[model samples]
Target: MLKTILSISGKPGLFRLVSHGKNMLIVESLTDKKRVPAYAKDKVISLGDIAIYTNETEVPLHEVLTSVKNKENGAKITVPSNTNELRTYFAEVLPDFDRERVYPSDIKKLLTWYNILIGADITDFTPEEEPATEETTAETETNAEEKTE
Candidate 1:
């Protein structure tokens, strides 16, 4: 039996898999429904959001089951229904997003959080800044003196 797990997605008419099997198990569904069968429970190869069927890995179906069961609600492995248009939509919009405005979070390196997300890999980011300017400082001293009076 072909113990396989398919991370299924679609790009318009072409259906693709996030292949994870030790053997090649790529196939196209002739039916109209959109569900990866339990039969293909382990033969999946996960590469980003893509699935491939090649001689690479050996994942048990139970692991996929466990992962799915344990997965956070929004984090489940799935493709949207408008997946056919996703690539086109992404291609058009991705470059427009403000990469220039993004600054890495101050706590990202200090807090041991998940690094799997593709955030900016900048070593130049600094957390601390010098104290406020002199005019602002003098206003604060004057306010303190007034408060004490």
Candidate 2:
């Protein structure tokens, strides 16, 4: 899901979280399947945490991505190079997207990200449910034992 997908600053494309290292993360590029170490100094952001400014409120990136998917019928879209046309295409996808706050460059990036995601066969934009941790499982067992006592 989006949580495991990362966008490293200065990096060309999105990366999938492969493993954790000391003071760094091992990330696999979504485009090339190449593994690289994203150091702690790098500004690594999960796609799940990103949101787009809207007229009324902020919309999560996943929702926006889903909207784009719906608009494109799950196919890669040709991002318009012209600024005005790009805005028009984005407006069709998100009608209430803030015209003032959302720059054309931002829209272009979103569309490009969508195309990359589609090309990588990453269609699911929803967040996956987090699995229970050891601490939580132990707490649950303790509670059950206390109740039985």
What is the lDDT of every predicted structure here?
Answer: 0.31, 0.93
Would you list the clashing residue pairs of candidate 2?
A: none
Our model 1 lands, by Cα RMSD against the true structure, at: 21.0
| Per-residue lDDT of model 2, residues 104-146, tens digit only | 9999888988988999999999988889999999999999999
What range of 10 consecutive residues in model 2 has the weakest lDDT sum? 108-117
What lDDT is reached at residue 113 by model 1?
13
Per-residue lDDT of candidate 1, residues 1-149 (tens digit): 11221233332222234343454444443223353332443333332222112134433322322233333222323322353343332223232322233212311211111111111121111123457999999999999999999
Model 2 Cα RMSD, Å?
Answer: 3.9
What would the TM-score be for candidate 1 when compared with the true structure?
Answer: 0.18
**Residue 87 alpha-carbon offset, candidate 1, angstroms:** 21
User: What's each prediction's TM-score?
Assistant: 0.18, 0.86
| Runs in model 2 lying further than 4 Å from the true structure | 131-149
